[model samples]
Target: MARTLVIDAHPDATSLCAALVDRYAAGAREAGAEVEVIVLRDLAFDVHLRRGLRADQPLEPDLVRAQGALIAADHVVVVAPVWWGSVPALLKGFLDRTLERGWAYRYRSNGLPQGLLAGRSARVIVTTDSPGWWLRGLMGDSAVRQLTRSTLRFCGLKPVRATRIGVVHGSTPERRESWLRKVSDLGRSDARRTPDAGKAMPAPREIASDAAV
Candidate 1:
Protein backbone atom coordinates (compact mmCIF):
# COMPACT_ATOMS: atom_id res chain seq x y z
CA MET A 1 0.00 0.00 0.00
CA ALA A 2 1.13 3.49 -0.75
CA ARG A 3 2.01 5.67 2.25
CA THR A 4 1.76 9.42 1.88
CA LEU A 5 2.73 12.10 4.36
CA VAL A 6 1.33 15.63 4.11
CA ILE A 7 3.13 18.46 5.82
CA ASP A 8 1.08 21.58 6.45
CA ALA A 9 3.18 24.65 7.17
CA HIS A 10 0.52 27.31 7.59
CA PRO A 11 0.50 29.00 10.96
CA ASP A 12 -3.22 29.77 11.01
CA ALA A 13 -5.29 26.70 11.73
CA THR A 14 -8.28 28.03 9.81
CA SER A 15 -6.39 29.25 6.75
CA LEU A 16 -7.28 28.08 3.24
CA CYS A 17 -3.90 26.34 3.03
CA ALA A 18 -4.83 24.07 5.90
CA ALA A 19 -8.14 23.31 4.24
CA LEU A 20 -6.29 22.27 1.12
CA VAL A 21 -4.20 19.86 3.16
CA ASP A 22 -7.32 18.33 4.63
CA ARG A 23 -8.84 17.78 1.23
CA TYR A 24 -5.63 16.22 0.00
CA ALA A 25 -5.50 13.88 2.95
CA ALA A 26 -9.13 12.93 2.48
CA GLY A 27 -8.56 12.02 -1.14
CA ALA A 28 -5.52 9.97 -0.32
CA ARG A 29 -7.45 8.08 2.33
CA GLU A 30 -10.26 7.46 -0.13
CA ALA A 31 -7.74 5.88 -2.47
CA GLY A 32 -6.82 3.38 0.24
CA ALA A 33 -3.43 4.94 0.83
CA GLU A 34 -2.17 5.50 4.33
CA VAL A 35 -2.05 9.24 4.97
CA GLU A 36 -0.38 11.28 7.66
CA VAL A 37 -0.48 15.03 8.27
CA ILE A 38 2.13 17.07 10.11
CA VAL A 39 0.92 20.51 11.09
CA LEU A 40 3.91 22.69 11.86
CA ARG A 41 1.95 25.31 13.74
CA ASP A 42 0.72 22.76 16.24
CA LEU A 43 4.17 21.46 16.99
CA ALA A 44 6.12 22.92 19.90
CA PHE A 45 9.59 22.69 18.41
CA ASP A 46 11.95 25.60 18.01
CA VAL A 47 11.81 27.13 14.53
CA HIS A 48 15.43 28.06 14.26
CA LEU A 49 18.61 26.18 13.42
CA ARG A 50 21.00 28.02 15.71
CA ARG A 51 23.89 25.68 15.15
CA GLY A 52 23.71 25.36 11.33
CA LEU A 53 25.38 22.05 10.39
CA ARG A 54 26.89 21.69 13.81
CA ALA A 55 24.34 18.93 14.56
CA ASP A 56 24.53 20.08 18.12
CA GLN A 57 20.86 20.91 18.45
CA PRO A 58 18.62 18.21 19.86
CA LEU A 59 15.40 17.51 18.02
CA GLU A 60 12.15 17.79 19.90
CA PRO A 61 9.73 14.87 20.22
CA ASP A 62 7.49 16.17 17.46
CA LEU A 63 10.43 16.58 15.12
CA VAL A 64 11.60 13.08 15.92
CA ARG A 65 8.24 11.62 14.94
CA ALA A 66 8.19 13.77 11.81
CA GLN A 67 11.58 12.43 10.78
CA GLY A 68 10.40 8.87 11.18
CA ALA A 69 7.27 9.60 9.17
CA LEU A 70 9.35 11.08 6.37
CA ILE A 71 11.57 8.02 6.27
CA ALA A 72 8.62 5.64 6.18
CA ALA A 73 6.58 7.54 3.62
CA ASP A 74 6.50 6.46 0.01
CA HIS A 75 5.48 9.99 -0.96
CA VAL A 76 5.76 13.36 0.72
CA VAL A 77 3.58 16.41 0.12
CA VAL A 78 4.61 19.79 1.49
CA VAL A 79 1.99 22.54 1.72
CA ALA A 80 3.18 25.99 2.61
CA PRO A 81 2.74 29.64 1.71
CA VAL A 82 5.35 31.78 0.06
CA TRP A 83 6.09 34.74 2.24
CA TRP A 84 8.49 37.40 1.03
CA GLY A 85 9.36 35.13 -1.89
CA SER A 86 10.22 32.14 0.31
CA VAL A 87 8.80 29.54 2.64
CA PRO A 88 7.59 30.47 6.08
CA ALA A 89 10.01 30.30 8.99
CA LEU A 90 8.05 27.49 10.61
CA LEU A 91 8.46 25.06 7.72
CA LYS A 92 12.07 26.02 7.08
CA GLY A 93 12.87 25.46 10.71
CA PHE A 94 11.21 22.07 10.73
CA LEU A 95 13.43 21.07 7.84
CA ASP A 96 16.59 22.38 9.44
CA ARG A 97 15.92 20.78 12.78
CA THR A 98 14.77 17.39 11.57
CA LEU A 99 16.88 16.78 8.47
CA GLU A 100 20.00 16.34 10.60
CA ARG A 101 23.41 15.10 9.66
CA GLY A 102 24.00 11.31 9.80
CA TRP A 103 20.24 11.10 9.35
CA ALA A 104 19.46 12.82 6.05
CA TYR A 105 22.97 12.98 4.60
CA ARG A 106 26.68 12.42 5.18
CA TYR A 107 29.83 13.54 3.40
CA ARG A 108 31.29 11.25 0.74
CA SER A 109 34.86 10.71 -0.41
CA ASN A 110 34.80 13.74 -2.70
CA GLY A 111 33.87 15.96 0.27
CA LEU A 112 30.36 16.27 -1.10
CA PRO A 113 27.39 15.17 0.97
CA GLN A 114 25.50 12.05 -0.12
CA GLY A 115 21.82 11.79 0.59
CA LEU A 116 20.62 9.06 2.94
CA LEU A 117 16.91 9.21 2.20
CA ALA A 118 16.40 7.76 -1.20
CA GLY A 119 13.61 5.93 -3.09
CA ARG A 120 10.92 8.38 -2.15
CA SER A 121 9.09 11.05 -4.17
CA ALA A 122 8.01 14.52 -3.12
CA ARG A 123 5.45 17.12 -4.17
CA VAL A 124 5.50 20.76 -3.14
CA ILE A 125 2.36 22.90 -2.99
CA VAL A 126 2.88 26.61 -2.45
CA THR A 127 0.38 29.43 -2.13
CA THR A 128 1.34 33.02 -2.78
CA ASP A 129 -0.14 36.47 -3.33
CA SER A 130 1.93 36.89 -6.49
CA PRO A 131 1.26 35.21 -9.81
CA GLY A 132 3.31 32.13 -10.65
CA TRP A 133 4.24 33.38 -14.09
CA TRP A 134 5.65 36.54 -12.64
CA LEU A 135 7.59 34.54 -10.08
CA ARG A 136 8.95 32.32 -12.80
CA GLY A 137 9.82 35.13 -15.19
CA LEU A 138 10.89 37.82 -12.77
CA MET A 139 11.71 36.32 -9.41
CA GLY A 140 13.04 32.95 -10.65
CA ASP A 141 10.70 30.82 -8.52
CA SER A 142 13.08 31.02 -5.61
CA ALA A 143 11.06 29.43 -2.83
CA VAL A 144 9.73 26.35 -4.58
CA ARG A 145 12.95 25.82 -6.49
CA GLN A 146 14.99 26.00 -3.35
CA LEU A 147 12.86 23.44 -1.53
CA THR A 148 12.80 21.04 -4.44
CA ARG A 149 16.46 21.40 -5.29
CA SER A 150 18.70 22.50 -2.43
CA THR A 151 16.61 20.80 0.22
CA LEU A 152 14.61 17.77 -1.00
CA ARG A 153 17.02 16.78 -3.75
CA PHE A 154 19.93 17.37 -1.47
CA CYS A 155 18.42 14.77 0.83
CA GLY A 156 17.86 12.30 -2.07
CA LEU A 157 14.16 12.67 -2.84
CA LYS A 158 14.01 12.50 -6.60
CA PRO A 159 11.68 13.74 -9.32
CA VAL A 160 10.14 16.36 -7.10
CA ARG A 161 6.98 17.97 -8.49
CA ALA A 162 5.69 21.43 -7.64
CA THR A 163 2.34 23.21 -7.91
CA ARG A 164 2.05 26.96 -7.40
CA ILE A 165 -1.30 28.64 -6.70
CA GLY A 166 -1.09 32.37 -6.53
CA VAL A 167 -2.64 35.82 -6.68
CA VAL A 168 -4.73 34.69 -3.68
CA HIS A 169 -5.09 38.08 -2.08
CA GLY A 170 -8.47 38.76 -3.71
CA SER A 171 -9.76 35.31 -4.62
CA THR A 172 -13.43 34.64 -4.16
CA PRO A 173 -14.71 31.83 -1.95
CA GLU A 174 -15.87 29.91 -5.01
CA ARG A 175 -12.46 30.23 -6.60
CA ARG A 176 -10.81 29.02 -3.43
CA GLU A 177 -13.08 25.98 -3.35
CA SER A 178 -12.11 25.20 -6.91
CA TRP A 179 -8.45 25.32 -5.94
CA LEU A 180 -9.13 22.88 -3.14
CA ARG A 181 -10.74 20.49 -5.59
CA LYS A 182 -7.66 20.64 -7.77
CA VAL A 183 -5.48 19.78 -4.81
CA SER A 184 -7.68 16.85 -3.96
CA ASP A 185 -7.31 15.57 -7.46
CA LEU A 186 -3.57 15.83 -7.16
CA GLY A 187 -3.71 13.82 -3.96
CA ARG A 188 -5.84 11.12 -5.49
CA SER A 189 -3.53 10.76 -8.46
CA ASP A 190 -0.49 10.41 -6.24
CA ALA A 191 -2.26 8.00 -3.94
CA ARG A 192 -2.92 5.56 -6.75
CA ARG A 193 0.78 4.82 -7.00
CA THR A 194 4.24 6.08 -6.31
CA PRO A 195 5.90 8.34 -8.87
CA ASP A 196 7.74 6.61 -11.69
CA ALA A 197 11.39 7.53 -11.43
CA GLY A 198 11.95 6.95 -15.13
CA LYS A 199 9.63 9.76 -16.09
CA ALA A 200 11.03 13.21 -16.71
CA MET A 201 10.36 16.05 -14.32
CA PRO A 202 7.56 18.06 -15.77
CA ALA A 203 7.58 21.84 -15.83
CA PRO A 204 5.86 23.47 -12.89
CA ARG A 205 2.15 24.04 -13.42
CA GLU A 206 0.33 27.28 -12.57
CA ILE A 207 -3.17 27.88 -11.24
CA ALA A 208 -4.20 31.48 -11.58
CA SER A 209 -6.48 32.76 -8.84
CA ASP A 210 -9.07 35.52 -8.81
CA ALA A 211 -6.80 37.72 -6.76
CA ALA A 212 -7.85 40.88 -8.59
CA VAL A 213 -11.53 40.17 -8.00
Candidate 2:
Protein backbone atom coordinates (compact mmCIF):
# COMPACT_ATOMS: atom_id res chain seq x y z
CA MET A 1 0.00 0.00 0.00
CA ALA A 2 1.11 3.55 -0.62
CA ARG A 3 2.22 5.59 2.39
CA THR A 4 1.35 9.22 1.96
CA LEU A 5 2.16 12.09 4.29
CA VAL A 6 0.33 15.40 4.17
CA ILE A 7 2.02 18.44 5.67
CA ASP A 8 -0.16 21.41 6.58
CA ALA A 9 1.90 24.58 6.55
CA HIS A 10 -0.80 26.99 7.53
CA PRO A 11 -0.72 28.44 11.05
CA ASP A 12 -4.47 28.38 11.47
CA ALA A 13 -6.11 25.03 12.03
CA THR A 14 -9.43 26.30 10.69
CA SER A 15 -7.93 27.77 7.52
CA LEU A 16 -9.00 26.72 4.04
CA CYS A 17 -5.67 24.98 3.63
CA ALA A 18 -6.54 22.71 6.51
CA ALA A 19 -9.90 21.86 5.01
CA LEU A 20 -8.25 20.99 1.71
CA VAL A 21 -5.80 18.64 3.43
CA ASP A 22 -8.59 16.84 5.22
CA ARG A 23 -10.48 16.35 1.99
CA TYR A 24 -7.39 15.13 0.25
CA ALA A 25 -6.72 12.65 3.03
CA ALA A 26 -10.31 11.47 2.82
CA GLY A 27 -9.91 10.89 -0.89
CA ALA A 28 -6.64 9.04 -0.44
CA ARG A 29 -8.15 6.85 2.27
CA GLU A 30 -11.15 6.02 0.10
CA ALA A 31 -8.71 4.97 -2.60
CA GLY A 32 -6.95 2.56 -0.18
CA ALA A 33 -3.81 4.58 0.52
CA GLU A 34 -2.42 5.03 4.03
CA VAL A 35 -2.32 8.71 4.88
CA GLU A 36 -0.88 10.72 7.76
CA VAL A 37 -1.08 14.44 8.41
CA ILE A 38 1.38 16.78 10.11
CA VAL A 39 -0.08 20.07 11.31
CA LEU A 40 2.88 22.40 11.72
CA ARG A 41 1.04 24.80 13.96
CA ASP A 42 0.15 22.04 16.40
CA LEU A 43 3.71 20.91 16.79
CA ALA A 44 6.13 22.28 19.36
CA PHE A 45 9.29 23.29 17.61
CA ASP A 46 11.29 26.37 16.78
CA VAL A 47 11.10 27.69 13.20
CA HIS A 48 14.48 29.29 13.10
CA LEU A 49 17.60 27.72 11.63
CA ARG A 50 19.66 30.22 13.58
CA ARG A 51 23.13 29.17 12.42
CA GLY A 52 22.26 27.96 8.97
CA LEU A 53 23.82 24.67 7.80
CA ARG A 54 26.91 25.12 9.91
CA ALA A 55 25.03 24.98 13.18
CA ASP A 56 24.12 21.64 14.60
CA GLN A 57 20.57 22.57 15.39
CA PRO A 58 19.32 19.46 17.07
CA LEU A 59 16.06 18.03 15.86
CA GLU A 60 13.24 18.01 18.36
CA PRO A 61 11.33 14.77 18.98
CA ASP A 62 8.46 15.95 16.82
CA LEU A 63 10.84 16.92 14.07
CA VAL A 64 12.54 13.56 14.27
CA ARG A 65 9.22 11.82 13.88
CA ALA A 66 8.32 14.10 11.02
CA GLN A 67 11.56 13.28 9.27
CA GLY A 68 10.95 9.60 9.71
CA ALA A 69 7.51 9.92 8.18
CA LEU A 70 8.95 11.93 5.31
CA ILE A 71 11.67 9.40 4.66
CA ALA A 72 9.26 6.48 4.77
CA ALA A 73 6.45 7.94 2.75
CA ASP A 74 6.14 7.21 -0.93
CA HIS A 75 4.40 10.51 -1.60
CA VAL A 76 4.38 13.84 0.21
CA VAL A 77 1.65 16.44 -0.08
CA VAL A 78 2.31 19.99 1.12
CA VAL A 79 -0.61 22.38 1.67
CA ALA A 80 -0.06 26.04 2.46
CA PRO A 81 -1.32 29.59 1.93
CA VAL A 82 0.64 32.05 -0.19
CA TRP A 83 1.57 35.24 1.61
CA TRP A 84 3.45 38.19 0.17
CA GLY A 85 3.92 36.28 -3.09
CA SER A 86 5.44 33.32 -1.24
CA VAL A 87 4.67 30.67 1.34
CA PRO A 88 3.86 31.63 4.89
CA ALA A 89 6.74 32.00 7.31
CA LEU A 90 5.62 28.93 9.22
CA LEU A 91 6.06 26.76 6.15
CA LYS A 92 9.33 28.40 5.22
CA GLY A 93 10.64 27.84 8.72
CA PHE A 94 9.61 24.20 8.70
CA LEU A 95 11.47 23.65 5.46
CA ASP A 96 14.52 25.52 6.62
CA ARG A 97 14.68 23.66 9.88
CA THR A 98 13.74 20.19 8.69
CA LEU A 99 15.31 19.71 5.27
CA GLU A 100 18.90 19.97 6.39
CA ARG A 101 22.17 18.84 4.98
CA GLY A 102 23.38 15.19 5.32
CA TRP A 103 19.81 14.03 5.71
CA ALA A 104 18.26 15.90 2.80
CA TYR A 105 21.45 16.47 0.83
CA ARG A 106 25.23 16.12 1.09
CA TYR A 107 28.26 17.11 -0.92
CA ARG A 108 29.59 14.29 -3.05
CA SER A 109 33.12 13.43 -4.18
CA ASN A 110 32.94 15.98 -6.99
CA GLY A 111 32.02 18.83 -4.62
CA LEU A 112 28.39 18.88 -5.79
CA PRO A 113 25.57 18.17 -3.39
CA GLN A 114 23.72 14.87 -3.77
CA GLY A 115 20.11 14.56 -2.74
CA LEU A 116 19.44 11.84 -0.19
CA LEU A 117 15.66 11.51 -0.28
CA ALA A 118 15.38 10.00 -3.72
CA GLY A 119 12.53 7.75 -4.95
CA ARG A 120 9.86 9.89 -3.36
CA SER A 121 7.33 12.11 -5.15
CA ALA A 122 5.83 15.38 -3.92
CA ARG A 123 2.89 17.66 -4.63
CA VAL A 124 2.56 21.26 -3.47
CA ILE A 125 -0.88 22.88 -3.09
CA VAL A 126 -0.86 26.67 -2.77
CA THR A 127 -3.85 28.87 -1.95
CA THR A 128 -3.77 32.47 -3.06
CA ASP A 129 -6.05 35.53 -3.34
CA SER A 130 -4.93 36.28 -6.90
CA PRO A 131 -5.89 34.42 -10.04
CA GLY A 132 -3.37 31.62 -10.57
CA TRP A 133 -2.75 32.24 -14.24
CA TRP A 134 -2.45 35.96 -13.69
CA LEU A 135 -0.03 35.44 -10.83
CA ARG A 136 2.10 33.13 -12.90
CA GLY A 137 2.11 35.47 -15.87
CA LEU A 138 2.86 38.52 -13.81
CA MET A 139 5.10 37.30 -10.99
CA GLY A 140 6.70 34.23 -12.58
CA ASP A 141 5.35 31.66 -10.08
CA SER A 142 7.94 32.15 -7.37
CA ALA A 143 6.09 29.92 -4.91
CA VAL A 144 6.15 27.01 -7.34
CA ARG A 145 9.84 27.48 -7.96
CA GLN A 146 10.62 27.70 -4.25
CA LEU A 147 8.65 24.58 -3.43
CA THR A 148 9.42 22.48 -6.47
CA ARG A 149 12.77 23.38 -7.97
CA SER A 150 14.48 24.93 -4.97
CA THR A 151 13.22 22.63 -2.24
CA LEU A 152 11.62 19.26 -3.08
CA ARG A 153 13.60 18.70 -6.28
CA PHE A 154 16.79 19.79 -4.62
CA CYS A 155 16.17 17.22 -1.90
CA GLY A 156 15.68 14.42 -4.48
CA LEU A 157 11.93 14.25 -4.69
CA LYS A 158 11.00 13.62 -8.29
CA PRO A 159 8.49 15.20 -10.60
CA VAL A 160 7.16 17.72 -8.09
CA ARG A 161 3.72 18.88 -9.22
CA ALA A 162 1.96 22.02 -7.97
CA THR A 163 -1.66 23.21 -7.97
CA ARG A 164 -2.71 26.82 -7.46
CA ILE A 165 -6.11 27.50 -5.88
CA GLY A 166 -6.91 31.15 -5.96
CA VAL A 167 -9.18 34.21 -5.93
CA VAL A 168 -10.49 32.86 -2.66
CA HIS A 169 -11.51 36.22 -1.32
CA GLY A 170 -14.21 36.96 -3.90
CA SER A 171 -15.11 33.42 -4.90
CA THR A 172 -18.64 32.12 -4.34
CA PRO A 173 -19.58 29.05 -2.33
CA GLU A 174 -20.43 27.20 -5.53
CA ARG A 175 -17.01 27.88 -6.96
CA ARG A 176 -15.37 26.75 -3.75
CA GLU A 177 -17.30 23.49 -3.83
CA SER A 178 -16.23 22.91 -7.39
CA TRP A 179 -12.59 23.40 -6.42
CA LEU A 180 -12.97 21.00 -3.50
CA ARG A 181 -14.48 18.33 -5.73
CA LYS A 182 -11.72 18.80 -8.25
CA VAL A 183 -9.05 18.30 -5.60
CA SER A 184 -10.78 15.25 -4.19
CA ASP A 185 -10.91 13.72 -7.64
CA LEU A 186 -7.25 14.44 -8.13
CA GLY A 187 -6.46 12.61 -4.90
CA ARG A 188 -8.44 9.56 -6.00
CA SER A 189 -6.80 9.50 -9.41
CA ASP A 190 -3.36 9.87 -7.90
CA ALA A 191 -3.86 7.04 -5.42
CA ARG A 192 -4.98 4.75 -8.22
CA ARG A 193 -2.14 5.70 -10.55
CA THR A 194 0.68 3.93 -8.72
CA PRO A 195 -0.80 2.08 -5.73
CA ASP A 196 2.77 2.03 -4.40
CA ALA A 197 3.82 5.54 -5.36
CA GLY A 198 0.99 7.90 -4.43
CA LYS A 199 0.30 11.33 -5.84
CA ALA A 200 0.12 14.64 -3.99
CA MET A 201 -3.11 16.17 -2.70
CA PRO A 202 -4.68 19.40 -4.01
CA ALA A 203 -6.18 22.50 -2.36
CA PRO A 204 -9.61 22.32 -0.74
CA ARG A 205 -12.72 24.46 -0.66
CA GLU A 206 -12.88 26.81 2.29
CA ILE A 207 -15.76 28.58 3.99
CA ALA A 208 -16.17 31.96 2.30
CA SER A 209 -15.71 33.92 5.50
CA ASP A 210 -12.57 32.03 6.46
CA ALA A 211 -11.14 31.99 2.95
CA ALA A 212 -7.72 33.48 2.29
CA VAL A 213 -7.65 33.29 -1.50
Best by lDDT: 1
| Candidate 2 global lDDT | 0.82
- Model 2 lDDT, residue 79, Cα: 93
Residue 67's C-alpha lDDT in candidate 1?
78
Candidate 2 Cα misplacement greater than 4 A, ranges: 195-213
Tens digits of per-residue lDDT, candidate 2, 16-74, equal 88988988888988998889999999877789898887878777667777887887788
Could you tell me every candidate's TM-score relative to the true structure? 0.89, 0.89
**True-vs-predicted CA distance for residue 171, candidate 1, Å:** 0.3
Q: Compose the digit string of candidate 1's lDDT tens values, residues 1-213.
A: 778899999999998889989999998888778899999999878888887876477667677678778877888999999888899898988988888887888889899989877888889999989986788889999999989998998998877999988678999988899999999998998888774234322332232233411
TM-score of 2: 0.89
Report lDDT (CA) for all predictions.
0.84, 0.82
